[model samples]
Target: MKAVRIHQYGSIDNAALEEIPAPKLGLDEVLVQVEAASINPLDTKLISGDMKDYFPLTMPYTVGTDLSGTVVEAGLLAARWKQGDRVIARLEPGSSLNKHRGGAFAEFVVVPAQLLTTAPTKLDLATSAGLPTAAGTAWQALFETAHLKPGQTVLVHAGAGGVGSFAVQLAKYIGAHVISTASAANADLVHSLGADQVIDYRTEDFSVALRDVDVVLDTVGGETLSKSYQVLKPGGFLISIVMPPDQEQAEAHDITATFFGHRSHAARLDLISGLCDAGKLRVIVDRTFHLSDMQDGLAHSASRRARGKILLRPAV
Candidate 1:
């Protein structure tokens, strides 16, 4: 099988597409013939060794986590998923357990049966690959962690990006008044995705323009995150996916804040799939690359200019 692997953590240039032996199935695993996989910032971070402390990897690690494909084989105990079942899954990046193993950027991958979820029927398998990490993280931050409620105001930074795009749509679906920051070029795109207001980050300062937001979803850390605390009302919530929040700043602003790490949950993914099928959710694919052009894909993702998800198809 052809797979993209990094022999040692360094740069995207280190990633190579090469022929490797097919992964052997485990008692509780299912083998999936990869159709498409999505590239994320996490993939680049893992390859660059930026997350080595949280996600330690063995040399020659495969590169990817979110994938959508069809089942080709299943272990005896994993018979629940039969042949030809369309599935989507997010492989663990080894954050909690500190053991990274990624194989989504390949022709085939072995997935733990428990991690599998039925892909959305409304979207093609290639598009469904965008849902796992991006949508899952947005869902976790808004619903699971922050407990965002309807009729409240929330701010989402970089609302046109992968996780931000989903966050805007999901927050709007739940009846929140969504505000977002994006480049002026993406203003219309962000508004169409359900953002009630789109602040042009390049020309406008969000902190000075908005105030007393009920929640702030900080996808852009550093100065943006620092400024986010001031926009929230007292006792409001500030959730960041990029980095940890400053406890002192949170206390000063009388807001609750914390960093979020997305986890792979079959049930959550199933719910997302349902929303997709119902047309309440949309997958915005910025670009698609052939599996052989993984370096270009990785570089594109690292550029952080993608309007939505960047995907890789195994076949042409």
Candidate 2:
């Protein structure tokens, strides 16, 4: 099997495509003939050691997490899935519960069956590869954490990007007044995705233009995250996917602050897939690259300007 991997954490230049043996199946895992995988910011962060304190990597690590593929073999203990089943999964970063095992940027991958969910029936397996992490993160933050309600106003930063795109759509689906920040060029794109208002971040400061927001989803941390607190009304919420929110700022502003770390699980992926199949959700793919072009794909993801997910087809 051909896989893109890095011997050590450093840069995208360290990632290379090499032929390696197919992974061994675990008692509760399945072997998948990988069709496509999506490159995420987390992929680059993991490769560069930015997240080492949280998700320490094992040497010679494979470089992807989100994937859609067909099951070719199943372990004896993984009877829930079988050969020919099309599935989408987000492999979790190494934590105490799950060991580090990221090999999705490959021709074949062995994944714990518990992480696999049936691919959305309305989407092709290739497109479905973009759903697990991006959409799941938006779903978890809006519903699970903030509990955004209908008629409430929510502001999503980076509206044209992966998670932001989903957040705009889902917030609108839940009947919230969705406002999003995007460049002027992507204004129409974000509006079409359900943002009621698309603020041109380059032209206007969102904190000054909008106020009394019920929920602010901050994808751009640092200065932007700091300014987000000013837009929220008293008792509002600020949720960050990038880094932890400053507790002192939260108390001073009289708003709740939380940092969301996305969890990948079959059940959450299943719910997201159902929404996609029902036409309430959509996946926006920014670009697709072959395994040989792994560096270019990683570079694009690292740029952080993608409209949505960047996909990699391993079998290409």
Candidate 3:
């Protein structure tokens, strides 16, 4: 099998595509013929050794986490899935418990059956590959953590990026008033994704233009995160995917704050799959790259300018 791997963590240039034996299946795992995979910012961080404290990589690590493909074989104990099943799977990052696994950016991969979910019937296998990480994160932030309600207002920072694009659509689906921040060039794209108002972050200060928001989903951390509290109403929620919120600031503002680390849940993926079939959600693909061109794709993701997910087709 052909796969992309990083022998040492330093740069995307360190990643290489090479021939390797197909992964051996375990008691509760399935062998998947990789059709499509997607890249996330976490992929870049893991490559650069920046996530060492959280997701320290095993040297000679394969480079992807999100995938959609067909099952070729299943383990004896994995009876829930069978040969030829079309599915989407996400390998949970920092899963200290599972040291032996295969990366999605390969001709084939071995995945724990429990992590697999039925792909959305409305989408092709390639596009569905973009859903697992980005959509799952947005779903967790808006519904699970913040509990955003109808008629309430929520601010989504970097609304044009991977997670933010999903956040805008999901918030609108929940009937909440959605406001999002993007550069002027992406304002129209964000609005089309269902944001009620799109603020040009480069030209306008969101803290000054908005007030009394019920929830703020902060994808951009640091100063943008610190200023987010000013827009929320007392007792509102501030959810950060980047880092933990400052406890003192939360206390002084009388609001709840939390840092969300997305966990791959089968149930959450099921709901997102349904939403896609119902047309209540959409998967935005910024670009697709062949496995041989993964370095360029990783560079694009690391650029922080993609409007949505970047995809890789191993079979391409």
All models: lDDT?
0.93, 0.91, 0.91
Roughly what TM-score does model 3 have, to 2 decimal places? 0.97
Q: Can you write out model 2's per-residue Cα lDDT over 90-182, one digit (the tens) per residue? A: 888863334546778999988888888999989989999999889999999999999999999999999999999999999999899999999
* Top-lDDT structure, candidate number: 1
Q: Find the number of clashing residue pairs for candidate 2.
A: 0
Candidate 2: segments with Cα more than 4 A from true spot: 96-98
TM-scores, one per candidate: 0.98, 0.98, 0.97
Evaluated against the true structure, the overall lDDT of model 3 is: 0.91
Off by over 4 Å in 3: none
Q: Would you list the rank order by lDDT, best first?
A: 1, 2, 3
Q: Report per-prediction Cα RMSD to one decimal.
A: 1.3, 1.0, 1.1
The lDDT of model 1 is: 0.93
Between candidates 1 and 3, name the one with more favorable TM-score: 1
